[model samples]
Structures are given as structure tokens and as C-alpha cells.
Target chain A: DTAVSQTPKYLVTQMGNDKSIKCEQNLGHDTMYWYKQDSKKFLKIMFSYNNKELIINETVPNRFSPKSPDKAHLNLHINSLELGDSAVYFCASSQRGGGSGNTIYFGEGSWLTVV
Target chain B: SQQGEEDPQALSIQEGENATMNCSYKTSINNLQWYRQNSGRGLVHLILIRSNEREKHSGRLRVTLDTSKKSSSLLITASRAADTASYFCATGSNNDMRFGAGTRLTVKP
Candidate 1:
């Protein structure tokens, strides 16, 4: 019954390792997004998908890729993880592709720590 | 990068008082929204003020937007200890919604 959910609330991995975070939204939304919040608490957008179509891909590193097998799920996979990759990743969703006063729902956030 | 930076990184208030936090953005926005995060929990949407609207209210929450100034403010009236949480302002453009660093409010009992 959760609107938006993410797996592995906390993740720890060594440098050069690979990791993946799964996200799902049961709100029947057409827009999904991935956001990263650093230790400084600056939340930034990484990627966005509208009904399973890649829409907005920010200046994120190429090593990181977002895969959406369906409209309800958006997974993030990190390759050659670096120490800087340690941050809180949030999954969010909205009813439409643009903001028309539509509120976006966020998950509990996946805390990733690359040692 | 279309980042909506919230001012006053932290705020501390006492019960029965009011709390106000401000956010400023550099680019145009379709709509601005406010969210609340209760510690380790997920962020909950508090309110959304569209470009055409000047203000919106929801229970104890009040949000005011001024697109001319490219800024917005959230005011919480009759604050309580339960209001202790991080408040963030997010602006959505197209399919992307960017969040600020958030204002960590500590409401003392």
C-alpha cells in the first residue's frame, strides 16, 4: 500500500564494487524520478522517467544507469562505485510528466556508503 | 543545475510558536512544493503552490509563492513538538523536481 518504496534502506560497499537499488511505486503514477542527497543535504535530481520512457537524465556519471522494466519500478545500478557515491538516494513519483500542481511522493531513501 | 536552495539551514522553535522557512530558485518553475521528512522516514508532501497561485493552505501549513522573486516561504502556525522535522522546498520543471538542502526545524516542548 506504500506510494513509493525503495529497497535496502542502508547499503555499504567497497570501492570499485557494484550495487543496485530497487524502487517501486504503487500509486499508478506516470512519472518517476531518482534523486541524490549528499551529506550536506543538497538534494539533486539524477534521472527521470515518464511511463517507463527515459526523460530527464541529469549530469550524472555514465557509470550509473537507471533501468525501468515497467512504469511501476525504477532501479538504479552503479558501476565502479567510488567513495563519492556515498549518498542518500531517493525514489519519487508523480501523476504526470510535468508539474501542474501535481505533488511528487518520495521513498524512505536508500543510504549508500562506498568505503 | 536548477537547484532550489533553502535558506536558514536549521531552525529551532518552541511549542505554541510559529516557524517560517524560505526557499529561492534560479530558474522558472511550473510549480513549487513543500515536503516534510520525519527523521529516518520518507518525505511527505505538505503543499504545492502553482505559478498562478499566490498562496495555499493545508491545516496548520501555509505556503506562499512569488514567482516574480523566484522564491517561496512556508509558514507553520501553532507549532508543536510533533513539527520537529526537516522541511524542504522543491520546484518542478518538466519531469524533474529539484529539492533544496532542507531546513531542519527543532520544536522544543
Candidate 2:
């Protein structure tokens, strides 16, 4: 079974178009995160939720919003997407937060390309 | 801003050779982790080294942490073609964890 899964493996949209990517984890983890990997392969944490509570919110713009309906699902919604938003989005989860000896599990990443 | 930064940016080696990637971080961390990402794939956790620990080994992957220097290194011995991927280092603090830019490794057969 895939521990972490993300929908819409590939997405191509135009500017000002809104899109959403869904993520789910079956590892029973308490912490879930959304990361953005740019063309340079630089991975940056955008948001993190622990047990459905927003814990870490990086300096991402308000256009990117993360919602966690429960402990098992975290979804990312982008409003009025821009060209700079093209990147691979990864959904990851861990047993808990703070990285206290916990190994993060990542999904097969959703590739987003804004035209 | 990324807390960790990987050195060399990229590495090329033969199938039987060894690959080494270094990571340097800005602040103190509870632990450091190494992850691998294949082309068009997600990052996979490889290993982790704690602040109190100096070195750790998992199979052919060896990791070393130096708190004083605020740096860590990941060494993969007898690298194979399948080992070709981008290696990243992550620094985990109290409630935050950040990843580096990553070093792309190409192991030619």
C-alpha cells in the first residue's frame, strides 16, 4: 500500500486559473506537510499540519492555501495561479512533528506546470 | 531561506566508485537527514544522524554529523547506476524542518 498518495500527478493550467491538489496518507501519522520543489530542485516547506492543526506556515504567498480536513488528508489549493508557481508539489507525512527522530514519507509528487 | 545547503551541486561517478555529498546548515539542529529523489519522483528518506551522534551507517550508506562545524556528509559506497539521483540534506529543529537544494548524482554504468 502506498503510505502517502497525491492526486493529479500532472497538472497544466493557464495564468489566473485556480487549481487544487489533494493528498492523503495512510501511515496514521500525526504530521503532514506540503513542499514545493522548483526547477533548481530546491525543496521548500510551504505548510505543515499536525493532527489537523496548522503548525508551520512558511513565507508562502496567500495564493497558496493548505487545508487539512482530518489527520489523514491535507489538500493544497492555489488561487489565481501565476507562472512562478510552476513546480513539483510533494505531500509528506511523519509519525509526529519536530522531526524528533521521525522519518518523513513522501508521495509520488504532483507536477504542476503553469503556462 | 533554506537552512541547509549542499555542496558540489552535482557529482558524476562510475558504477563501482563512491559518491560523497556534503551539507552545511546555518543553525543548530536536533538531527540531520539525507534523502534521495529520482528523476521526476518524490524524495525518499535515506538516513538520519542525531546531534549527539558523530557517524552512522546503513548498508552502503554512511552518514556523519559534526555539530561544531554545523555540517554533515553522506557517503555511498559502490554506487550503481540505479543510485543516480539527487541527494538532499534536511535540518530539523524544534518545530521546523528545512531541506537543501540537493546534489545531483550520476552514476554511469
Candidate 3:
């Protein structure tokens, strides 16, 4: 079974458009995260949800919102998509506990492009 | 902001040669991890080394951590073309993890 899966693998929309990417993890993990990889391959954490509760919220713009229906799923909604929002967004999950040994499993990532 | 920075942004090596990537981070960390991402693929966890541990090995991949220097290095021995990928170093405390820009490696056969 796929450990972590995300939908809308490829998305291209015009500016001011809104879109959503859904993610699900069958790893039974408590912590889930949304990461953005820029064109230079720099990965940055945008948000983290533990057991469906917002745990970490970076300085992401208000246009981007994350929703977690359950521990197994976390979704990202971007409104007013701008050109700067073009990047690869990844959904990752990990067991919450015992320090940094918790290995994270990442989905295939959703490629978002705004023009 | 990104906390870790990987050195030698890109590397190209011949098959059977070794490729080494180094990472340096700011502040203290509970542990450090190495991950690999193939072109157009998801990131895969390679190995994790705690602040207390100095070195760890997995197959031909060896990871060494130097907490005193706040740096870590990943060495891939006998690298093959299949081993070509971007490698990232992540440092974390208890619940938070941050990744570096990553080193792009190409092993030519």
C-alpha cells in the first residue's frame, strides 16, 4: 500500500484562482506536514498538524490554509494563487514521539503552477 | 527560514567513485537526518543520527555527525548511476524539523 498519497499531482491555474490539494497517509502517524519546494530545490515547512491539531504554523501567507480532517489526512487550500506560489508541495507524515528519530514519509508531491 | 546549508551544491562523479556531501546547521538539534529525492519523485528517508552518536552506516551509505562543529557529512561509496539524486539534510528538535537546500548528485556510468 502507498504510505502517503496526495491528489492533484499536477495543477496549473491562472492568478487569482483558488485550488486545493488533498493528502492521505495510511502510516497511522500522528504528525502531518505541508512543505513547499522552491525552484532551487529548497524545502521549507509551511505547516504541521499533530493529531489533526495545528502545531506549527510558519510565516506562510494567509492565502494558504491547511485543513486536517483526521490524523490520516491533511489538505492545503491556496486562494488567490500568485506566480510566486509556483512550486512543488509535498505532504509528509511521521509518528510523533521519541525525539528526532521519527522518520518522515513523504507523498509524491503536487506540482503547482500559477500564471 | 532554512536552518541548514549543504555544501557543494552540485556534484558529478563517475560510477564506483565516492560522493560526499556536507551539511552545517545553526543552533542545537536533537538529531539530524539524511534524505534522498530522485528527479520528480518524493523524498526518501536514508538515515538518522542523534546528536550523541558520531557515525552510522547503512549499506554503502555512511553518515557522520559532529555536534561540536554543528555539521554532518554523508558519504556514498561505490556510487552507481542509480544513486544519482538530490540529498538533503534535516535537523530537528522534538517536534520541528527543517531541511537544507540539498546537494544534487549525478553519478555517471
Candidate 4:
């Protein structure tokens, strides 16, 4: 069974359109995170949720928002998408308590294309 | 700019040879981790070394962390063709994790 899973493996939409990506973790982890990898392959952390509470919120634009209804699910919604929004978004989850020594499990990733 | 930048963005080696990649981060971290990503796939966790731990090993993978210098290195011995992938280093402070650009390793037969 997959530990972390994401929905909509590929999404193509036009500008000014709204889209949402869903993520779920089966590791029973207390923390989950969202990351974006651009064309340069530079990975950037967007948000993190601990036990359904928002933790780390990066300097991402307001158009991008993350909603975590619970510890096992975290969804990302992008509104008024721009051409620069084309990239691969990854969702990861990790157990709490042990810190960095705790291994993180990643999802297959959702590829978003803004036309 | 991204934290935890890797060196030698690309490397190619024979299947029997060893491969090493280095990463340097700007801030002190609680721990550092190494992950491998196949082409167009999600990352696979390889190893994790705590700040107090200098070295860690798993199967044929070896990881070393130098907290004083805020750097880490991953070495794969007796590499195989399956080892050809992108290796990334991630540093975590608290529960937030960030990854480096990663080094693409191509192992030929």
C-alpha cells in the first residue's frame, strides 16, 4: 500500500481558472507538508500542518492556499493561476517526536500546467 | 536561493564504481536526510543522520553529517544501474523540511 497518495496526477488548465490538488497520508503521521518543484528543479516548501494546525507558511502568493482538514489529508488550492504556476507539487508526511531523524514519506506528486 | 545546495549537479560512473555527492546548508539543523528520486517519480527516503551523529549506514548506502560545517555527504558503494537517479539532501529545523536541487547520477553498465 502507498504511504502517501495524491490526486490528479496531471492537471492542465487556463489562466484565471481555479484548481485543487488533494493529498492523503496513510502513515498515521501527525505532520504533513507541501512542496513545489519548479522548472529549475528547485524545491520550495510551501506549508506544513501539525495535527491539522497550520505550522510553516512560506512566502508563497496568496493565490496559493493549503487546507488541511485533518492530519491525514492536506489539500492545495490555487486560484487565478499564472503561467509561472506550472510545476510539480509534492506532498509528504512524517511522524512527530523524533525530529529530523524521522523519515518522511512522499506522494507520487501532481503535475500542474497553467496554459 | 534554495538551502542545502548540492555539488557536482551531475555525475556519471560505471556500475561497479562508487558515487559520492555533497550538500551544504546555511543554518544549523536538527538532522539531515538523503533521498533518491527516479526519473519522473517521487522521492524515496534513503538515510537520516542526526546532528549529534556523524555517520549512518543502510545496506549499501552511507551518509555522513558534519553539523559544525552544516554539510552532509552521501556515498553509494558498489553501485548498480538501478542507482542511476537524482539524490537530494534535506535539512530540517523543528518539523519543517527543505531540499536541495539534487545531483543527477547516471550509472552505466
Candidate 5:
């Protein structure tokens, strides 16, 4: 089974439109994260949730909001998306404690293109 | 802010040759991990080296960490064409883990 999975492997939408991507991990992990990869393949952490609690929130704009209904799920919603929003979004999960638990497992990724 | 920065944005090598990638982080870390991502695919965990360890080996991959310098290196031996992909270094401190821009490696068959 896929350990970490995200919906809409690919998405294309017009400017000003709102879109949401859902993510879930079956690994029974306590922490989940959302990362954005730009055209240059620079991956940046947008948000991180530990056991449904917001832990890390980068300098991303308010247009980007992350919601975690439970520890195994974290979703991202983009409001009034701009052309700069075109990038690949990745969902990942990892255990909370130290040691090997720090290893992160990533989903296939969702490609978003805002026109 | 990104914690790690990989040296040599890109690398090319022939099969059977070894490829080395270096990573430097700004802050102290609990552990450092290397991940490989193919074109249009998600990142896959390669190996992890903790702050207390200086070297680790898994198969043909070797990882070294120097907490004093806050840097790490990943060496891949006997490279194959299938190894052509982008490699990333991530630094984990407490609950926050950050990734670098990554090194794009092209292994010519």
C-alpha cells in the first residue's frame, strides 16, 4: 500500500481560482508536512503539523492555508491562486521521536500550474 | 529559511565511477538525511546519519557527517544510469526539518 498519498496528481487552473489538495499517510506517523518545489527544484517547507498541531509555518503568504483534521491527514488550500503558485506540492510524513523515526516518507507529489 | 545548501548544482559521471555530493547547513542538527528524487517523482529516503556519527555505509552509498562544521557528504560508488536523479540533503533539528536545493546528478550509461 502507498504509505503517503495525495490527491490530484496534476492540477491546472486559472488565476484567482481556489484549489485544494488532500493528503493522507497510512504509516501511522505523528508528524506531517507540506513542501513546495519550484521550477528550479528548490523544495521549501510550507507547513508542518505534529499530531494535528501546527508546528512550523514558513513565510508563505496567507493565500496558502494548511488544515490537519487528524494526525494521519493534512490538507492544503490555496486561495486566489497566482501565477507564482505554479509548482509541485509534496506531502510527507514522519515519526515524532528521534533516531530512525526522523526519516521522511513522501507522496508522489501534486503538480499545480496556475495560468 | 533552508537549512542546508548543496555544492555543485549539477554533476555528471560515467557508469562505474563514483560521485560525491556535499551539503552544508547553518545550524546544529539532530540528524541529516539524503534523499533521491527522479524526474516527476517524489523524493525517496536514501540514508540518514546522526550528529553523533561520523560515517555510515549502506550498500554502495556512504554518508558522512561532521557536526562541528555542520556539513555532510554522500558518496555513491559504481554509479549506474538508473542513478540519474536529483539528490537532496535534509537537516532535522527537533521537529523541524529543512531541505536544500538539491544536486542534480546525471550518470551516463
Candidate 6:
């Protein structure tokens, strides 16, 4: 069974469209995160939630929002998506927040294409 | 802005050889982790080195962190074709985590 899984593995939307990617973790983790890997392969953190509480929100644009309904789920919603928003989004979970020796598990990634 | 940046961008190695990649960061961190991502797949955690630690090892992988230099390195021993992937170094801070641009490694059969 997959420890962390995300839906909408591939998404293609026109500019200004709204879209959402759903993520879930069965690993009994308390910390969940959203990371985006751009065309240049630079992986950047977007948001982090610990036990369904928003903890870290990077300099991501206001068009992007992350919601955690519960400790096991974290969803990303994008409004008015732009061409620059096209990238691979990954959902990950860790047993705890950032600290020494806490391994984070990543999902298979959701590829978003904004045209 | 990205905190860590990998050197050499890309590398090609022959099977049975060893591959090494380096990463440099701009700020302090609690720990540094190395991850591997096969083409079009998710990233898999390889190894982690704490700020107080100098080196750590896993099955066929070894990671070393030099907090003083704000850098880290990953070494894969006896590499196989299956080891072909992009390797990234992620630095974890109190607030969040940051990943490098990744080093694309190709292991020739």
C-alpha cells in the first residue's frame, strides 16, 4: 500500500482556471507538506501543516492555497492558474516537524500543466 | 530563494563504479537529507545527517555534512544501472525545508 498518495497525477488547465490536487497519507504522520518542483528541477516548499494546523507557508502566491481537513489529508487549490504555475507538485509527510533525523516520505507527484 | 545548490549539475558513471555529488547551502540547518527521484517518479529518502553529525551511511549510500562549510555530499558506492536518477539535497530549518536543483546521475550499464 502507498504510504502517501496524491490524485490528479496529471493536470492540464488553461490560464486563469482553477484546479485542486488532493493528497492523503496512511502513515500516521503528524506533519504534511506541499513541495513544487519546477522545470529546472528545483524543489521548493509551498506549505506545511502539522496535525491539520497550518505551520509553514512560503512566499507562494495568493492564488495557491493549502487545506488540511484532518491530520491525514492535505489538499492544494490553485485559483487563476498561470503558465508559470505548471510544475510537478509533491505531497509529503513526516512523523514530526523539522528536526534531526525525521525522514519525510513523498507522494508520486502531481504534474500540473497550465497553458 | 533556494538555500542549497548542487555542483556539477549532471554526472555519468559506469556500473560498478562510485558516484559522488556535492551540495552547498547558504544558511544553517538542523539536518541535511539526500533523496533520489527516478525519472518522472516521486523522491525517495536516501540518508540524513544531523547538524552535529559528520557522516552517515545506508545500504549503498553515504552522506556527509559539514555545517561549518554549509555543504554536504552524497556518495553511492558500486553504482548500478538502476541507480540512475536525480539526487537532491534538502536542508531542514526550524521554519521549513529547502531542496537543491538536484544532480542528474546516469549509470551506464
Please tell me how candidate 4 rates in CAPRI terms.
medium
Clash numbers, per candidate: 0, 0, 0, 0, 0, 0
Write the residue-wise lDDT of candidate 3 on A17-112 in tens digits. 999999999999999999999999999999988899998899999999999988999999999999999999999999993245899999999999
Q: How many pairs in model 1 have backbone atoms within 3 A of each other, for residues 3 or more apart or on separate chains, i.e. clashes?
A: 0
Which segments of model 4 are wrong by more than 4 Å? A97-99
Docking class of 6: medium
Docking class of 2: medium
Q: Candidate 6, clashing residue pairs?
A: none
Cα deviation of A60, candidate 1, in Å: 0.5
C-alpha TM-scores of all predictions: 0.96, 0.98, 0.98, 0.96, 0.97, 0.96
As a whole number from 0 to 100, the lDDT of residue A22 in candidate 3 is: 98
> Which runs of model 5 end up more than 4 angstroms from their true locations?
A97-101
**Local error of candidate 4 at B21, Å?**
0.1
Give per-residue lDDT, candidate 6, residue B78.
100
Clashes of 2: 0
TM-score (C-alpha) between model 3 and the true structure: 0.98
lDDT of 5 by residue, A2-93 (tens): 99999999999999999999999999999899999999999998888899999889988999999999999999999999999999999999
Q: What value of lDDT does candidate 3 attain over all alpha carbons? A: 0.92
lDDT of 3 at B22: 99
Q: Candidate 1's residue-wise lDDT over A25-104, tens digit each?
A: 99999999998988887788999999899999999999999999999999999999999999999999989853667888
iRMS, model 1 (angstroms): 1.6
Of the pair 1 and 5, which is ahead by lDDT? 5
What is the TM-score (0 to 1) of chain A in model 2? 0.98
Interface root-mean-square deviation of model 6 in angstroms is 1.6
